[model samples]
Target: MECVFCHIVRGEAAAHLVYEDRAVVAFLDARPLFEGHVLVVPREHLPTLTDLPPQLLGPYYAVVRRLAGAVQTAMGAEGSFVAANNRVSQSVPHFHTHVVPRRRKDGLRGFFWPRGRYPDAARAAEVARRVREVVSADGAG
Candidate 1:
């Protein structure tokens, strides 16, 4: 079976994509912790962050950094939470960085997982577009 994220990266699966380039692709999380939550992944099918090639690290994280700012701005968030899991807690085996929009007292607490979904596909697409706009304007896309 092919990795779902690899499918997304290859345009073989549907995703609310916010950013894409030769090295990485970013899209909205189907199950998000908050509105505008995005997942950044490499084009290659690396299983974990540690598995990412050293040459790709700078380029990969550069996109993550850009998306972190764009997601916060697009969501009108006070800040953003960026995280990654190794093999232990990774829902998908493919490597990814979660960029979650955050606000003061938004009910997320340390080490506690709370997940939510967009009310509809239209809503999710709108959120992705907003993030994409910011990323494009910032010259990160």
Candidate 2:
């Protein structure tokens, strides 16, 4: 219950949710390296990538693939940076994949750690909802 991403998935906490399905939820990162940086997370609170169930792997990656394209296309970025953390640098206890929008020499150098906050919760939720709409129609997660 203390896991923040879990609360977000349940709508118990505010998040910029862009995509959802049976297995996964994708949302805007509260503090991001770029405006459209998104977090694709599993619905079940798996603590790390190695903790993921084998049955859920396909569905999860499908959602991530969809969101990667959405982040680039929707945010008008030339490319995308898709990555995840295990125990190290894992901000939340739950597992998550980062789908960040990228441009050439956009000052996102190094470990891609620069972060920024949303101007307001409404804006964050709005962006997340919009992303959700795009990824939802692609197929079932």
Candidate 3:
């Protein structure tokens, strides 16, 4: 099907992966609105959640919950946001869930944005460090 996520699932492209199982794979977003943003997706490449098999529905939710927890812990954010897009908003044309860490004053009043850069490498490092810690600890099980 030539889906980008399918290639990601097959390890054809590089991704900062957080988790994976027989049916799904989770990885960091390359162009993150928030630093710890990650995408949880099925390996099968369904176009939307509704298109997923009944058997996959349970595991998908479980992965979402698990990824949210990991994102919060890793990014040291005040909270987390999880979203699934169905139609026009679905940028990648594949069924995926976004787990984004939310800070108290990130200026992101809503999901839409055109923001500035990290200013320096240190900020980016902080995000990466925390995400790595949380994902590593959580994935141990």
Q: Rank the candidates by TM-score, best first.
A: 1, 2, 3
- The prediction achieving the highest TM-score against the true structure is 1
Q: TM-score for each prediction?
A: 0.78, 0.77, 0.76
**RMSD, every candidate, angstroms:** 15.9, 16.2, 15.5
Candidate 2 regions with alpha-carbon error over 4 angstroms:
110-141
Deviation of model 1 at 38, angstroms: 0.2
Name the TM-score of candidate 1.
0.78
Error of 1 at 29 (Å): 0.3
With candidate 3 superimposed using the best TM-score fit, by how many Å does residue 103's alpha carbon deviate from the native?
0.9
Give lDDT tens digits, candidate 3, residues 53-141: 88999998899999999999999998898999997789998999999999888877876767688879999999989889988997732
Residue pairs that clash (backbone atoms under 3 angstroms), model 1: none
If the candidates were sorted by their lDDT against the true structure, best first, what order would they fall in? 1, 2, 3
